[model samples]
Target: MEPVNDIAQLVVNGLMSGAILAVPAIAFSLIFAVLQVSNFSVAAHIALGAYAAYVVNTVLGLPIVAAVAIAFVAAGVVGVASDHLALKPLRRHGPITVAIASMALNLVLENMLRFGFGNTVQALNIPVYRDWVLGGLHIAPQQFYNFLIAAAVMVALFCLLAFTSIGKAMRAVADNPVLADIKGIDPEFISRLAVFIGMGLAGIGGVLIALDAAIEPTVGFRVILPIFAAAVLGGLGNVAGAVAGALLVGVAEELSLLVLPVAYRSAIGFFAIIIALLFFPRGILGKR
Candidate 1:
């Protein structure tokens, strides 16, 4: 009975963590699906988003909602800028060139963050720390909130993609940019919009994480690999797959704690990625 309880707790923890991870994973997958470019700078965007929220909360003394809004808008703008100033111009240079450019941008953003915010860790002061206990299981308020918000956002994204004109256009462009353009869809505009949405989602994730845990200049770097693992495991560019992969990775990481040290928990993501690639090269849900 005790062991079963432990397993349940682990599962709960995994679900909570996975909910937080799904946001960025979905965002990363969205960008890749549309642009076919692995934007490594996404991690930087996450950090920037959190920092933007911090500024709004600390410097401006705004409410949490305002901070989150600022973060979302700021990150979305950065995403669009990256696409226009760097990615769009380098389109003809090939994926490798674009990827390298993104890496450079990521470095630049990270350094800028470090210079401006310093290397100290920061936390958001959201006044919600109560937890609910159910069936001998403990659940933090933030954890529940994170799950709810993530789930809501994912559903909203699905609706946007499934039932809206812009969503159809985005999907059309993703399926075949040249064909979409020929059909009167502006591929460039769609690409920018995709990046904007992706970064906006990342910003929301960053803010949630900041509220739940301490954030630092390197916070984005720390989670980027796990998010990538989730994206790859779900089959890159598959939005629904990314969420599924994030949950799996989160559960796997939590379960690994039974045998592995806390410090090495993050290695679980890398292991998952490697194993997935070896057995399922196209990802569990990735279409070849």
Candidate 2:
């Protein structure tokens, strides 16, 4: 019974963590589906956003809310810049070239952070949002807030894709870029929007981590693999799939603590991915 209770607590923790993971996974799938290239620098972009927030809060003595806002805007701008400066120039070079460029840029950003921030790990020191007791669960305020925010964002994104003109245009571009170009959809502009949104998602994800705990300069480096796995499992370009995959991975990872040492908790994701690939190569929802 005690072990079972511990498993339950772990599941709660996983859900909390997975809620945050959904943001990046969704962004990854969004870009991969629409642009046909993995934004390998997603981790860097998110880290930069968190660092920007940290700077604003620490150096400028701004509130956490204000710092997050600034980070959000800055991250979006960086995403747009990536499309314009790197992906755009190589649009004719195919996704392989774009992915390579993204990876190169990621390296540049990671090194830049190391040079600027040094090797110290820093905590944001934001006050925890709230604490609530519901049923037998001890729920942190941030968990509820994050879950609500994630759900709202997902719903809003879904509506945007389902009912808006920009959404339709983006869909057209994703489906057939040449046709979209011939139809005057401006694939570059659409792609820029996707990149910006994707980066924004990554940025907010970082903020969530900062809000939840301490952040290190190299933190985002650890985020990429799991996020990609979640995204792939969710189905490429499928937002719903991303969210579902995140939840599943989070729960499984958390529950694994029942038998596995806590030290190897992070390794669970890798093991799960391997098992998932072997059994369901198309992932939980199938590739989009």
Candidate 3:
């Protein structure tokens, strides 16, 4: 491939990765917006999903798709469980209290995985689909599929939030939990649903990451920063912001390779978030 073609490929790959990150970024924003609490233990759920995929694929010899599906379901369960056990108890407290609880939950869950999985990196072996190259741009089937999947999912989410009563209730609760409750909305139920969607999306992100890279005990920790940065850059409670932010972060991270070491690519998200906040303050969309 020509140099220009290589750069194009890199850009495309970055966009694909960005879309994957957006999945969880949107989820994170949704939960935080609705519950007014940031679930720091979201990292744990990501790890759980990846590890679950590893187990099902490596141990049970299941297909990667099936394993990922199972992992998503499990992550949803864990999200609901965490809300019920760790977060619900602290709901009356300020958002800071829930954030702290999330941090604690993060530690507990990470330690548990370390104990059970032995602090090693596990690779998920998935068969590759055919790749297509056009006009010097290389398009891996999986990466293209990822982009399609993410885009479709985002569209579905938008439609759901726009047209569904539950979606309206969730948005109402997010805007004002107290008023929502008085208006007959169940804050607890909304919170649970938010958790379910957020963590499930996080799990999907994990599955994508695992598909692209090795699953390590520390993998979730490594990804949390970038994903969080994307969420913040997009706007704390805004789905559109999350998608935009994820793409921006992804492109920045990839293009940074021109002058900076590859290791610093991950830091682009933080820098971008800081800069975006410095300028927009309320975020790009000013949702919250």
- How does candidate 3 score on lDDT? 0.83
User: Which is the leading candidate under TM-score?
Assistant: 1
Q: Which stretches of candidate 2 lie over 4 Å from their true place?
A: 1-4, 129-131
Residues 226-257 of candidate 1 have per-residue lDDT tens digits of 89999999988889989999999999999998
Runs of candidate 3 with Cα error greater than 4 angstroms are: 1-6, 129-131
* Candidate 1 TM-score over all chains jointly: 0.95
TM for every model, in the order presented, reads 0.95, 0.89, 0.92
Itemize residue pairs with steric clashes in candidate 3: 234-241
Assess candidate 2 and give its lDDT: 0.79
Per-residue lDDT tens digits for candidate 3, residues 149-258, read 67876887888788999889988998888999999999888888889888887777778778877887677778788788888888888888989888888877887887
- Winner on lDDT between 1 and 2 is 1
Better of 1 and 3 by TM-score: 1
Per-residue lDDT of model 2, residues 128-182, tens digit only: 6657866566789877777776676678778887899998898888778899999
Q: lDDT of all the models against the reference?
A: 0.89, 0.79, 0.83
Count clashing pairs, candidate 2. 2
Q: Lowest-lDDT window of 10 residues in candidate 1?
A: 122-131
